[model samples]
Structure formats: structure tokens, C-alpha cells
Target: MIRFENVSVTYDGSARPSVRGVDFEVPEGELVLLVGPSGVGKSTVLGAVSGLVPHFTGGTLHGRVTVAGRDTRTHKPRELADVVGTVGQDPLSHFVTDTVEDELAYGMESLGLAPAVMRRRVEETLDLLGLAGLRDRPLSTLSGGQQQRVAIGSVLTPHPQVLVLDEPTSALDPAAAEEVLAVLQRLVHDLGTTVLMAEHRLERVIQYADQVVLLPGPGERPLLGTPAEVMAVSPVVPPVVDLGRLAGWSPLPLTVRDARRGAAPLRDRLTDRQPRPDHTARPPQPAPPTPGRRLFKRTKPDTTAAPPVAEVSSLAVRRDRVQALRHVDLTVTPGETIALMGRNGAGKSTLLGALVGLVEPSSGSVRTGDAIPHRTRPRDLVRRVGLVPQEPRDLLYADTVAAECVAADDDAGATPGTCRALLSDLLPAVADDTHPRDLSEGQRLTLALAVVLTARPPLLLLDEPTRGLDYAAKARLVTILRGLAAEGHAIIMATHDVELAAELAHRVVLLAEGEVIADGPATDVVVASPSFAPQVAKILAPQHWLTVSQVREALR
Candidate 1:
């Protein structure tokens, strides 16, 4: 059991508490979903239970928090480790071991458990997390979702009665996320692990949660109750829940399957649906189109060529003592957009790094023919390739947003004076001196992309670039990437947004434990692969389209 008595946490260095006066409890063996937009203090609440709030994070606590009758204020992380196992949004941040097997054993080894006990727990975790075949694999070799599962397995190896996970599926593709979520649901239903997890993708896991704790947006009170109860009164609800409300269904549908059943007057509703056939199917692209060689009109670049754009033969990378990429082979032809798919640890990022030389392959080769990617005299990768990392701010360093792009010589794109320009399409006051870091997560992402556009690289590598963004921002990113692809740039992105992949990517490269499990057209691989097909898309396709507009269009 977990209890919070009017607990309000305020970080010492901050002016306001991340979460305001909040109180809630989880009876033993209940799965609670804590949700809100990014930075709403959902993590802070979980931190309070794991002793990270006032301890590791160092904040002022106003009220009391008791976990299974033990005062949370007094217990340190190590002290609470046995009772609570926590995982964060980013898998790399919390990782300590170099291999999957070693990672599973790390937590137990730290607790000084018997070797025999540790071995048994490791084997059990491998089976429980569906990682039995990956015991000997290197941690860096698995896909993003696989890596995340490994993280979960490591934490669960201790068999903590209560488990707290923050955005466990945020970094995974739809199918991979579903695989992980299914395992989580099984943990609560079968093993009875008290689960407290926070996520932004509510539509995917809402039905699985026994309780939903909603931290309303600013100037609103937090809500806590059963999934149906809280969702009824809550400001943000899933599509299915909204459908239930609109359709006047008795019990709101938590899942899409239920939503379909509740939608009894579907044909009648379709008769009233209007048609907007002059519609555009393009993504909400963040960056404006780059000016190609033609000055008068923005002409499409030549996409078709004889040889492939990138070819990696027997590529390998080692992290610490473990091999991340073990003799992996991959190829991307000109004008092809490939979505890199895998569970969390599947060396997607590592493989991407080797392309531009961020990581040195231990053995094998990464060859870029005559037009080598970022093969410039200086390490100005922008000349050939542009990389947008998961955390957009990592590449940002400028006083004003406009100046940041200008620093990258974005002005090289003909005369901006020609159009009074649509730079303000994304940012309002693109003054020459606003610090990039001061902007919101969505704004910062747009700014970063704009900077990359200045480079005009033929090959673009985006790494989970949609993270911490809203629906609008995600839509914008998809549009931008698709526009770039249409204009002839070959994009390879390691992303967890499966819907984005389904809509934008032309091809997909599925990786598992650092090996290229499958590589081909996106439709063929993702549709066929067990852990790559997006759940929402799967639920809506064939009879109906997955996207909102697609359904509306079909009805029309």
C-alpha cells in the first residue's frame, strides 16, 4: 500500500513545486496510471514514494508519505530499493551494466544476494520479460523497446512488491510499446506487483490501468479515481473515451475495440459526416522547404541514383566490455526513408552514431561511396548529413532563436527578404537574440529543426525527435520529415512513434540485439514483424484508417 498525506513537493532551487498540494493512495496490488502533459510533476509524485523527491532530487516536502507503512521521508534510495524498483523515461540515463545478463544481475549483486539466488532471479526475469533468448546479448545491441524491457527486467529481478515506472513506453514504437505494456499488465494481474506508472500516451495503456491519477493542467486540481470516473470528469481523455461521451454510451470505452462496439450508430453518424475532399495529406512539417539549386522555384532534388546512399557491412561497436553492434549489415538507397525499429537496447542509436563517426566500430566497415556522408574537411556534418538527437537541446547553443539558425548559416537559402518570410510560422517573434533553451519543448524542437535545415544535408538522421512533444508538435514533426523525404533526402530515424513511422517512413530496418532482423519496405516489415506494427494503426486499418482524418475521409 502507498499513501500520500497532502504531500506537496518544492525543489530547493525552484520557485514553485512541480506538483502542488496532492494526496492519493494505491491499495495493495492495484495498477495506477499517473498522467498529465510533460513537466506536470507526475514524476515528482512517484519520486516521493521512492525517496527521490526529497532525497536524491533534494526538495522541500510539506506533508507525509508512507509506503507500505514505512515513512518515505526517511528512507534513502538504497534503503527503499528492496521495496520499490523505479525506471525512468530514458533507459541510457539509468543503465550501469554493458550487457543484458549483467544488467539483470546488477541490482541483485548490489543487494548482496546469494549467487544461486541471483542466477535463479535472472533466469526468471528473462522468461517473465520475454528476454530468455537475449541472456547472452550485449545491452547496446538490443532495440530501444528491448532495452527498456531489459531495464524493467533488471528492476523486477528483485521482486519488489511495488514497482514505479515513468514513461516506460514513451521511447518505444507502438508494437514494442504494446509488447512492454502487455507484460506490465501481466505483472499486475499474475504476479500482483503494485505498479505506478506515468505516461503521456494514455490511449495505449488507459484500459490496462485499474486507477487513473490525473494531474490537471495548470490552475486546476489533480484528479484521482477509477479509470471511468476520473476520465469522465478529467479534462484530457483518450479518443475512445471521447467517442463514448459523444455517442452517449453508458460505460465509456477505454479501448478502441470497446469504442467500436459502443459506436452502434456508426452508419447513421457517417451519413451526417461532411466531406472535405480538397484536403491535404501532408504532415505538419516544422522546417520550411530548403531552397534547392533553382533560384526561381524550389525544385525537387534528384532522388534516383545508381548506387545506394549508405552501406554498412559487418559494422560492430562495443560499450565497455560488451559488443553493441555485432557484424551488422544494412543499406539505404537514395530517396529511401527507413524507420529504425527495435526494443530499447537494440543498438539503434549506436548504429546511427557509427554512420557519422560518433561511435567507432570495433571491427567491420561503414562505407559511404564517393559522396561520403558528412565527409568534409572540417567535421561540419551539416555539409552532408543533419542529425536531430532525442533531446533537442543537446545541439542547441545560441542567444536568440533566429541567431541560432543564422549561426548555422541558414541564410544560405537564397534571399529570406523575398517572402517577408514564414519563419514566424513556427515562432512568433524570431528576434535575433532569444536564447534557444528558454523556449518550450515544442518550440525548442522546431528551432532545432530549423537550424538543421540551414545545413540542407541530403541525409537526415533523427533520433526519437518527437519526445516530450504534444500532438500538434508531433504532427508538425511528421509533416516536416515527410516533406524532406519527398524533396529527396534519405532519412533514417530511430524513433518510438510507430504511428509516425507508419505514415512517414518508406522502409523500416528492424533490429534485435544489434542484429538486423529484417530490412525492407515499411509496409511489409512493420505489418509483418511481431513487435513493430503500431497498435492504433493495427486497430483501425483495413476497415478504417488509423489516423483521425483517414476515418473521417472513409466515412465521407
Candidate 2:
């Protein structure tokens, strides 16, 4: 259904081609997964199929791309709307309407479908995507995952023969991600819809792909083969596949069920073992006052203890008719890392917003240090709290990475190059001269994080910080955040990355319908919930193993 022949894309003023000499074909009714590290131009290749690379993106394309026998070189995105549907990584940019139902119908209307046909498709798409309850909600009020679903529903309503998606399930919870994947499976098996997708979260979609495409890097020939064939050598793989490799399993498994079937021996090997002990530090206690201190004497400040950084008491946030959060109470002392997790639209983002003073509470209060975050001045608030929002671009406005770092330093009154130094630590491969827009999704997120950290706030909040990061990048992030936590910075992250939560978070707080339903230690919370359990935990059931690193250490 889609074909690329010797395709090469080079943006303006770039010496190297983003993607070079790529050749691949997707059968009429199969799913093809594009896998690669960050900054490898997976997006560029997907754009070529929808005729957006050279047309809308202002790039030069060398060779040919076709969808359903229509040459993309001759047809623009609008011209190929009936045959192709493209949903990008940033769903907010893809939206044209303000509400959910209208967005779903917009695509069908653009195709000049009859009113009856459009209405039928709208209802069906809403039900299929599990957006029925959110049908009337405004796009702005919805969470990141909900917006992603709406963006996908908008494209799916047109009933295009080919669907090109980038990071389709990055924002979704595991159960919701599974639901979306199941719908795609049905579309391929029952309706024969062709899907070409690029996803950083391989564990969610690897099992569903009929074939896998590996883009090793720029100027490297892309590898295309069956899922098993490609996974055997692919560097970027899901945790289950990694576990299979570690155990030398024959015919490496791609799904949890398959992994579990081959895990009998590994389970026996770990039968008497225990998971590594949790090592998250407790809050520091205040030191005793100095003895024999004269009254009103000049004294040095006590540096033994760091004060409470963030405290939310009975906080409630309401947007339009949706009560985003209700009676949410949280406290973060120094050196504690908390992971706020839940289903999509479960108030994770809302809680993050409240901490950073973006959302005004309908009731109760939020305190960062001695000041109320909602009422503090912007300049003063920067010293107390910093937030890396769900969409990283919201914090980036400069032309280049160096310029952004300079701007961040100026805004935070830090020494020159402080932000640049942080950027290098977070993402060393990104060039100093590269435009922020040119960076990949993971790179952009890291840049935003560096910008926020330049302020050195006592309380740090991150909303879906691991959205587009690969395993190596995620490992770097884990090291950075752990270092920050050890230095007495309180970190609160709102995320759907279960494995990340299991590995990095000291505690997990689960939300449901704007209410805190479960809150406890990370292992206790995740192991009890099947939807939130990591792959290793699922494969070795009742063993309480959360990560490969922990298991490796125990075996050692």
C-alpha cells in the first residue's frame, strides 16, 4: 500500500541528509513498525509517505514515495487525504477544532462525505477510541493522552487506506495503549487498513507489528524483515526481548505471553532470590541548635536540613465542567522522588499544573516553600518551583540550542553558560548550533528540562518526561534525576511510563477520576496492579521483580 524507492530527504542548509537511500514497502494489509534511536529521522521517512516532507516541510526529496499507487511527489497532503491519514507526534499541532466531537468529524467533512455518513463515522470513531465520555470536552481541557486519542480519532474517521502515525501510544496508559493497539490490529486483520508507525515505546506495539523496519542511523541502509528476524539484531528492543536475549531463548519472544512461556527456567533460577532493597532516602531531620549561643549573636545559617519543598492540601481544580482534581493532598520533602500515575484524564497533569501554579485550585491550597505558588510572582516563583510541561515546545522559543541556554541563564539570573552546561550533561550529542525545532522529540524534551533546571528550584515537576526517549536516553535521564534527588531536590513526575516509575520513583501515587485511589511504595503499588506492572514482573509473576537491573544485581 505504501512504497519508498531510494528516498533521501535533506533539509535546507544541512550538509547531511536526514534520511538517505531508504527503500521499503508495506503490504496492503499489514502493520510496519519503524524503530531507531533519537535524532535518526524516523519522522522524515514517515512524512515522505504522506507527501509532507518536501511539500509542507520545505525539504528536498530525492526519489519516489507512493501510497495506494498515487505518487506522493505529485500529490500534496490534501490531495491524498482520502488515501492517507497522518497523525504526528505533537497532536496539538494536528488539531483544527476545539472540541472532541467536532475534531472527529472534521476529517470526514473535508473529504466531502454526506452528513449522514459523517455522523455515523463520528459516533463509531468516538466509541472505538474510548472517547465516548469525552465527546463534548474541549481539547484544551483534556489531558495529553486524551488529546492524542482525539487526534487519532480525527484521522481514523476519514477511513483512509493508509495510516501513518508517530509515537501513537506514547501518552497513553498501558491499558489504554493496549486498547488503541487492539483497534489497530482489528483494522489490519478485519478491514485490511495499512499502518506505518514510529514508536519509541516498543513494548506496547511490537507484538502487533507484522513486519519491523530498522533505521540504524543517518546514511545507513534501512533494515526490513519479519518482527522476529529484525528483533534478533535490532539494538532498540522491548524489555521482554532484552530478557529473551539475556536467557538465550530460541525464537526470541516479542510478547509477554511468549516471554512467560519461556521463563520457567529463569524463574526457577530466581526462586529463592529477593528483589534488591529500595534505597530511596528518607527526609532529613533538623539538626540540634548550637550550644551556648549568645542572645541575638551573629550566627551562621544551619545547613543541615532542607525545608519541605512542596505541600498540597485538599487541592481541587476545575476546568469548565470537568473537575480535573479533587481533594488531592500531597507532600514532598527534600530528596524524595514521587511518581504520579493513572489512566488518561485521571488528573496527573492537573496535579502537576497545580504544583507549578499553572492551574488555580477551586478549593484548598498549594505551597512551595514559604510562598503560595498560585499567588507568587513569576520571578520569585522561578526560584521555588520549575515545571517541564507535557509539551516540551511550550518552554522553548529560541532559534538554536545555544541561544535557548543563554536565554534561560538570563531569565534565571544564573552565570553565563550554566544552562548550556546542563544541556550537555542531559544531551551530549545535540549540536550547539542546531535549531530547537530541528531536534528530535526526545532531544527537545531534554532541552526543555535543561532550561527548567537552570533555575535550580527547590521543587521540580515533570509531566510525561519520558514521552519520546529511547532506552539509552532514558538511562541517562534516570542517572540525572537520581543525582538531583540525592542532592536534596524534591522531584514530582506525572507519567505513564510504568517501568520508569518502578525504577526511579521512591513512591507511586495512582489517581482515578480526579481522586487519589492508591498511594504507597513503588513496588507495593505496581506489583499489585497488572496494568501497571513492568514486563519482567509480568514474566516472573509473584516474584516482585520490577526491573532487569534489580534482577541482575540479585543474581550477582
Candidate 3:
């Protein structure tokens, strides 16, 4: 259904093609997963399908890209809208309507479909994506994951023959991501829709992919084959596949079930050698006085007791008459990493907002050191707390990455090259002169994080920090966060990436309906919960293995 022949794309100012000589054909009714490291031009290839590359993005396309025999080189995105539907990395930019229901119907309305058809498809999409409860909610009010569902549903309502999605499940929780993937599976199996998607979170979608497309890097030939064939040598792979490799399993398993089937011996082997316990055992100094006690520890005036960098007590946040957060209480002491997790619209973002002073609590209080975050001055609050929002672009304004870094350094009162150095450490491949807007979603996230880290605030908050980051990038982030925590910087990340929570979080705080449901050590919380369990935990069930690294160490 979608074909690319000797395709190469180079932006106006770029010295090299973003992707070059990419030749592939995605059969109808198949889902092809496009994956590679950050800045690898995965998004560039997906854009060619819907004619967004040369036509809409102002890049030059060298060869033919056709969807259903219509050459994208000759046809514009609007002309191909009927046959091709594209959902980019950023969902907020795709919405043209205010509410969830309206956004879902907008694409069909543009297509001039019958009102009845539009309404039926809208309802089906809402149910399919778990957006029924949110049908009336404003697009802006929904969480990042909710917005992603709406963006996907909006395109799906059009019922295009070819669906192109970039990081479709990046923002979604594991359950929500599975729902979206299930819907995609149904589309491919039932309606014969061709899906071409690019996602950095391979673990969530690798098992669902019908085929795999590996873009080694810019100007490199693309590898296309069955999922196992491609993943056997693919640099970026999910933990299940890595475990399979470790055990030397033939025809490596892609799903947790298959891995578990072959993991009996490995599990027995690990039964004797205790797996390294997760890093949640190290509680912050002067651990809460009692199980339910609220201890008010502060950075010392003349002593060495570094108090909790952030504290929230009896917090309630109401927006648009909806209780986004209710009666929540939490504390983040220095040298601690806390992960906030729950279903979409469960108020994870709202809680993060309250911590950063972006959202005002309807009742109760939030304190970062001596000052209440919402009441503190902007300049002063920035030094005490820094947030890398889900939409990292909101934190960036300068055109070039170098300029943004310079501005960040100035704002943070850091050394001249501080932000740039952090950027290099986080993402070395990204050119300093590249426009922040033009960087890949992962690269953009890294740049935004570098900008935030420049401040070196006592409390750092990240919302969906690993949305588009690949395995290597995520590893670097893990190291960075660990270093920061060691330096007495308190870190709280609101995320749905369970693997990340397993790797970095000392404590896991699960939220639902604007209330904390579970707050405890990572192993007890994630290993016991099936939905939030990482691949390692799933494969090594009852073994408490949270990461491939942990398994490797245990085996050694």
C-alpha cells in the first residue's frame, strides 16, 4: 500500500540527507514499525508516505514515494489525506478543535463524510481508544496521553487506507498503549488498513508489529524484514529480546509470553542466585518519623540535615470543576527519585504542575524549601524547582539549539557553556546550529532537558522524560538522573514508562482519579502489578528482575 523507491530527503540548510536511498514497500493490511536511534531520520521516512516531506516540510525528496499508486512527490498532503492519515509526534499541534468529540470528528468533517458516518466513527473511536469518558473534555485540558489518543482517533475517524503514526504510544501508559495497539491490530486484520509507524519505545509495540523497518542512520540503507529477523541484529531492541539473546534462544521471542515459555530454565537458574534488589531500598535521610507521620525536615541553617526539597500536604487541585488532584500528600527529600504513574487523566500531570507551581491547588499547600511554589516569585522558584514538561517545546523558544542553550545558561546564572555542555552530554549527535523545532522528538526532549538541568535546581521534575528517547539515550538519562540524585538533587518524574520506573525510581507513587493509590518501593509496586511491570519482570515472573542489567548481574 505504501512504497518508497530510492528515496532521500534533505532539508534546505542540511548538509546531508535526513534519510537516503531508502527502498521499501509496506503491504496492505500490515503494520510496519520504523525504528532507529535518535536523529536517525525515522520520522522523515514516515512523513514521505503522507507527502509531508518535500511538500509540507519544505525538504527535497529525491525519489518516488507512493501511497495506493499516487506519487507523494506529485501530490500534496491535502491531496493524499483521503488515502493517507499522518499523526506526528506532537499531538497538540494536530488538533483543530476544542473538545475531544469535536477533534475526533474534525477530520471526517474535512473529508465531507456523511454526518451519520462521522458520528458513528467518532463514537467507535472514542470507545476503541478509551476516550468515551473524555468525549466532552477540552483538548487542552486532557493529559498528554489523552491528547495522543485524540490525535490518533481524529486521524482514524477518516478511515484512510494508510495510517502513518510517529511515536503513537509514546505518551500513553502501558494499558492505554496496549489499547491503541489493539485497535491498530484490529484495523490491520479486519479492515486491511496499512500502518507505517515510528516509535522509540520499542518494548510496547515491538510484539504487535507485523514487520520491522530499521534505519541504521542517516544515508544508510534501511533494513526491512520480519520482526525477529530485524531485531536479531538491530542495535535498539526491547528487554525481552535482549533476555532471549542472553539465553541464546533461537528465533528470539518478541512477546512476554514466548519469553516466559523459554525462560523456565533461566528462572530456575536465578532461583538460587538472588536477583539484585531494585534501588528503592535507599530512602532519603531521616526517613519519615512514622508510617503516616509528616516529618518537616529542612536544609540546615547551621547543621547538615538537608531537608525535603519539595513537600505537598493535603493537596487538592480543581480545574474546570474537575478535581484533578485531591487530598494528596507527598514529600521529596534530597537524593531521592520518585516516579508518579497511573492511567491517563489520572492527574499525574496535574500533580507535577502543582509541584512546579504551574497549577494552583484548590486546598492545602505545596512547599519547595521555605517558600510555597505557587506563591513564590518566578525567578526564585526556577532556582528551587525546574520542570521539564511533557511538551518540551513549551520550554524552548530560541530558533537554534546553541542559542537556546545560551539563553538557558543566562537564565540559570551558570557558566557560559553550561547548557551546551549538558546538551552534548545528553545528545552528542545533535548539531548546535540545528533548529530546536527541527530536531527529532527525542533530540528535542534532550535539548529541553539540558536547558532545564542548566538551572541545577534543588528539585527537578520531569513529565514523560523518556517519551521519544531510545535505549542509549535512556541509558544516558538514567546515569544523569543517578548523578543528580547523588548530588542531593531531589527528582520526581511523572511517567508511564514502567521500564524507566524500574531502572531509576527509588519509590513509585501510583495515582488514580486524582488520588494516590499506591506509594512504595519500586520492586513491591511494579513487580506485583501486571500492567505496570517491565519486560524483565514479566519474563522473570516471581523472580523480581526489573531490568536486563539486573538479570545479567544476577547471572554473572
Best by lDDT: 3
Candidate ranking (TM-score, best to worst): 3, 2, 1
- Stretches of model 3 off by over 4 angstroms after superposition: 283-304
TM, every model = 0.75, 0.95, 0.96
lDDT of 1 at 135: 85
In model 3, which range of ten residues has the least summed lDDT? 287-296
Model 2 stretches with alpha carbons more than 4 Å out: 278-306
lDDT tens string, model 1, 1-556?
Answer: 8998988877664556667768888988889998765446777788898998888777698889988888988878888899999997667767898888999999999889999999999998887677887788777656666777888888988889899998787777665577778878888898888999987667778989999998875324578888989888776665566546655777877876776664546535554443232112221212223444421233444433436556888988888666678879887655567788786667888888777657777887775534443334324555566777765777787676656665556433434432122234444433555566545454566677666655556677888866655444566667666555655566888976666676577677888778888877665666675455554344433322334444445554
lDDT of 2 at 19: 92
Q: Model 1 misses residue 492 by how many Å?
A: 3.3
Candidate 2: residue 405 Cα off by (Å): 0.6
Tens digit of per-residue lDDT, candidate 2, span 74-121: 999889999999999999998998899999999888878999999999
lDDT on C-alpha atoms for all candidate structures = 0.69, 0.87, 0.88
